[model samples]
Target: MKKIYITFLFAAISLFSSCDDWLTVEPKDMVTVDKALTTPEGYTSALVGVYQILQNVYNPGGFVMGSGVDTFANIYTEPSIGFSQSLNSAYNYNFSDTSYDNSSGAAFLQMYKAITNLNVILSSIETTEVLTAEQKNFVEGEARALRGFLHFDIWRIYGTAPDDNAGTSNLILPYSLEVSNEFIPYLNYNDYFANILSDLEQAKDMLSFSDPIIYYSNELLNVEGSIEEYEDLGWYNRQNRFNYYATLGALARVQLWMGNKEQAYEYAKEVVDAQNEDGTRKFRLGTSTDMGNTDLALFVEQLFGVETLGYDDTSYSSYTAHCVNSEYVLNQVYPSSSDIRKMNLFTTLTSNALVYNAQISLKYSLMSENDASAYKNFPIIRVSEMYLILVETAPTIAEAQTYYDTFANSRFDENVTLTEGNLQENILNQYTREFWAEGQIFYTYKRLSLTSLPFSGQEMNTDKYKIAIPSGETNSDL
Candidate 1:
């Protein structure tokens, strides 16, 4: 359980970048942590630094998001030649392979690095004289939420499932709370999740009163305006941040994972029913029109996500090269040809002199003529997922069917029937279609403890669901 902490200097300078005026800190301006955090601008930059880590770790090619996690789910077809060896290892569940282990290990360290930064902010934000009381609440709330968010992912990726009785009792991963290099003891599954929920609940309480998203719509807050206009408004771009709704959404997800079905249903319903002052849904489901216009990431429906740079260029190139599924697999996942996802989310690449013909996902690929900046959104949570949660956690089978019908109607112009037997199958199908390269379907299989995967009928077990902890982490004290 002994873990080393990244120094404040490295966390601040290495992760900090120019996203906005407040966050524009140059690496040349080397200053101690105390001096950097003396001003409101410095604290803001530090928080933005944590977000920057998210942008890096969850980008399309990052281990948690695109190639790594999706490959673990067996979402792609390995080409006859020139495929990435690391991804091939992931697809085969070869976590012990050196390349795959190194990739996953790097991502693990990056997440903890971000957590260290968050701990630094939380430790200093309250007593800082430069920030107002409201500013303190906002910063602390966001830090707590991000802390919970990062720990949840770590547990999902590395810890045993709560459903496993023996695994639940065994000490797993340390939930780091302080910015110290001291050894922290690992906790059982119950204690680990309790820490996650504690952070989230405290965050929810603080953000409810302090977050601007509570009173204003994301449309108005994120609306394009002059620099002076935005400066006057204080905070903008609530969609990308862990806003109030996103906290609730995260709660619902965690509750469902821990088998708190009633709580999950309630939390999800609140988010689904949330509205702006104008009565429009806070986060609406994406439609065919959105896909037709090349907004394939469905930016409108994202509850919480990061706006990434080069998502379509560098990050997506990895997908096009190694993660392309064959036409046959795509058909199996999307049985309804009329489904809008099927129609717009895929394109067949013709065989060339060097590469063979294959079907690839357009979810992350943006057209050149369109506003690429607007489409570079990488969703971590969406309203569509809230509906999915509702379907699974609904009180009765009929209630589940109603939620599914609503979600299905929004995606395409179709009337699909649902019954008790097929309801669970349909839900799984939607996960495959809705979150193809978004890195969620794999976790769904794990949470449900499915003995077989959907498309390939690959055998599954607890060992496959849990990734091996990186060797460096295992032998850290040495």
Candidate 2:
């Protein structure tokens, strides 16, 4: 049996980057609650810290899963002969390999630690007097949303699917509401979903009252009509944080996972219905022209995303290793000869001095020299996904067709028609292309329980759909 343990002190250490110098402190195993949560700014700083950790979740490569990992949605192929030790077992689906234990174990610990930090902020918001009612609500809402989001992710990777599995009584992950170091027993699948929904609903309610666009309008310089007076309030970054729509998007996703089609459609509709004062959609679909000479224009389509500060180094390496020079996988994803993405979203190097000439995806690849770091933000959700959810849960074929057409027309010159018979399958295929390296493709396969995929030599196996719990936590009080 694998020995499991949770280090409260080490987890307590903040892994936030000190680039902004907002909450910089010496490296320590523990951070006292009073020192980090006494002031309103401190709470906000902690939230930023959470975003930093999230940005690092898949660094040196944006894909959370390893390249050529059969256990995951094997969309990309690496030309390299071998993978790092942390990803070897993942590639072969060998759960018993102790060498792969650290990768999952470290992520598990970090996610829980971030949850604990969010709980601390949530706890402090009620008592902290420095913040006004609006500030308190905004802070509390973002914290709860982050907490719910993280827990939902943990449940997806570690918890067995209640929909796919016949035996739904097994306990999976430790879902906690408090910041204590005590060992919380795992909840059944039903109870786990309940806990996740509870957090998300509370977050939605809190954020409904705060209204991120208006509340943070001063900080959003990119948008029109800058409120100069409120600009000094800090927290200027928009793409990195969980705004109102992001929270709603999370709710819609959770509802879909629970098989609540009506509720999912309702929430997704709310996201799609969101419009600016001028009647434009809050999030709009991208155009072929938006692909541009560089991928920088793609940022305008993000409903929610995280700015990867290490993009130049991390995303560049990951894209080159897995996608560039791998013609088979590249052709598999963007298979259509006339696909605009194949032409606009990719570029090939041709200099004789270069080591090799290969096509790399400009979507995730960063070009810092051109000041495209703003486009380096990784998308978590988009309006395009809202359309996908709407189509997936639409009651009528006509309604689903409308939603599908709205998205397809935006991306392709030819009108892609959808019939009720092939709606689900086509939606899955669209997901394969739409998300590409966005990380939702794997979850789509798992959620729908469909067997075949775009990966080379993929077989139908339900067990491979879910990742095994890392050895470090196998015997712990989970």
Candidate 3:
């Protein structure tokens, strides 16, 4: 599908300002929320606006410094030229002054803006006369799911670890329930998690009847026909939206992060089992053959992602600047030829004399040659992540091995096997390989608090793990 650009005129919604506090602008919009949702087309357009923040956050070069989750996580390699210039603070954990720069701060601000828009859509949908109840539920489900997702990410970046039972007393962020400028105080980690999960559970119920993205084909055949085409019913590709399965996947991820092993395993197992053995599943793991002949490509059967319109044309240079000549990590960790990830998803640049052979991440940057592979939607969750969750949270080592081997067998050219003894070792290895440049590796280490990383000699350090609140937000002038 051609990437659709939904114009979110922030100027129109000046009431939802991108201010330091993110809430001190006039309520000026060319179209009001009630009028905007009066038609299905307008409703979809507004829904698309809620998704715009993902593209902004995932865009490689926009606010490299403020991209705290990946930057602080140390997800990329130090460039040959700017090893000390660019990412010096993040790599060294120097986030006191420079961590919350304008770009990073803007990312944090934009998510709130998106949430504000989502809140408007959710409140208006109840009284929206033009849309069917099913249509309203679809929009409500996606809005709540996206809200939960954005808030959860905010917590990850700013708050203490969810599993920190001791840190439950400290509040970090407010769960914004309505579109208002009122300063919401931070809830403790446990309370914050409860609110986020509550939204996700509501999302799951709302999207139960909604269509899902079919795995191998990446199509949404379920929502194709019979519905009144609102500007041709643009919702067919529900993969771009947070469908039912996506919420399940998110539940699995959140549960695992919170240290709830049994619940995490159950949720992940549900997502994994959502795919059919007969190949009719809404989502499944991609094969090496599925990656096609291109060296620069992303696995397209993503459970949840945002379609990035003109991403390659606009942001490729900025993305490569941070990634191209930097020290690539897969070179050190992925030593096996049987693993197809090294061959399909990664490309080596030997011309960089400083790093010798920098293995650049082609996960989201492969849109140059093939349009088919260029769906720049940053993947929020994937099928393999469920398998990884199961591996880490299973009740027994034997059960963990069952999950591990299923993933290993599918990813490798030759059949691969793992024993109970090597379960922890291999899970970390798989995390590095599977989530290489997708901005997940650091969280894996942070959540688990591993003393050492897989390839790099970087150990668990206090500076690297914590991100400071932006000075603007810290002011008592709310």
Candidate 4:
């Protein structure tokens, strides 16, 4: 029994990296919270296990699962939907119903699995005599917040996910995890956000302990200790776990999405104020440094993200071990003075480089063997976003100016300030440039109901903003 349970535990952790046994962990096997969290290691393992799965939720090399691991959605590059419209299958763009339908399953599967783990934590924390009350609450908060965070992701993608999981009626994911044949309840937009906000609001208060180490390296680098020293206190740092914080960010984001500007401003402010000890803000700007400094520093922006914490050392390394070289932005990089990402951060290819190289994949640079691993962890909901939310939602132009001024000047070294007539556009455009390659680009475009003027060549539809509910999800139930 011990061996079987232990195997299940290890298998869960292994799932994140496509480990031999990890990929096969079945969802049907029931492991009680009491049994899973019997020890501190068990509890930690459960939490970390879910996070590891996040690394694999999407395939990073291409679109779909890891496509937009960092904030930038890499595969979607076009005028419609702004950057991610697909011209060919190779581009792997899924801006409409099909993408959302398929993605919802994958997203829901992982989130539900994590939620189950959290449910276990929530249920057992009370019975476990060894765990402290605060510890129990912290863990529970992490789980609930994470559950809310992922659900919000689903809602964002599908637009009408419901609270009830009847499976037959609503949009849900993971054909493998479904236990019921009945229709699932699809959440309306308002309720979707309400649940998200509720979870985050509680998570904000539930999380107590704080770990100051803000950067987390890929576990693969740990072979050389590159990913090993992720924390100053080193035993898994669940205290500053991203699942909870991500929930807070989702709350602010959903609030903004719902046009509750005041609440958006409120929650976003909360996240900004919760910076790392060194004052390097979470989900803020990248490390404005030269890229070639380490040949592997190209993507160092997200090295120590909350999700990367406690994950296996080789996860990121393996993800980035093999990458095709691209030079779409060589001009951007060579000019150096244009955007700092090209100038100081990215390197110009030499005589041996390919002439048809695409843009320098501005979000991340090469790690080992020119794979995407070098790009650091990009915060999905960084502290800077909160400020932007406030500025955009400011009650008046003067208030907007005040918030926008502080946020813009502080985010980049250039110190951008908005002028009178172009207040909203200025802030929105700045968000585009500042957070390019990061995933928030589309959302920014969405909130404003603005469409790209025209890309270099591609045609974009201003009306085709919200991805329609995928046909797979539009059964008789919804």
Instruction: Compare the candidates by TM-score and give the number of the best one.
Output: 1
TM-score of every prediction relative to native: 0.89, 0.85, 0.83, 0.64
Model 3 bad stretches (over 4 Å) = 1-34, 62-68, 79-86, 163-167, 212-232, 275-279, 293-300, 313-320, 324-329, 351-354, 368-376, 413-421, 461-463
Pairs that clash in candidate 2: none
Clashes of each: 0, 0, 4, 50
For candidate 4, lDDT tens digit of each residue in 57-119? Answer: 533332322343222222222222332223221122344434434544444445455554554
Whichever of 1 and 2 has more TM-score, that candidate is 1
Tens-digit lDDT track for model 2 on 95-204?
A: 66666566667777767767766776676576788887878878888888888888888777766554665336666666767755545566767777788888888878
lDDT against true structure, model 1: 0.76
Ranking by TM-score: 1, 2, 3, 4
Worst 10 residues of 1 by lDDT: 16-25
lDDT of 2 at 382: 78
lDDT of 4 at 21: 22
The global C-alpha lDDT for each of the candidates, from Candidate 1 onward, is 0.76, 0.65, 0.63, 0.45
User: lDDT of candidate 2 vs native?
Assistant: 0.65
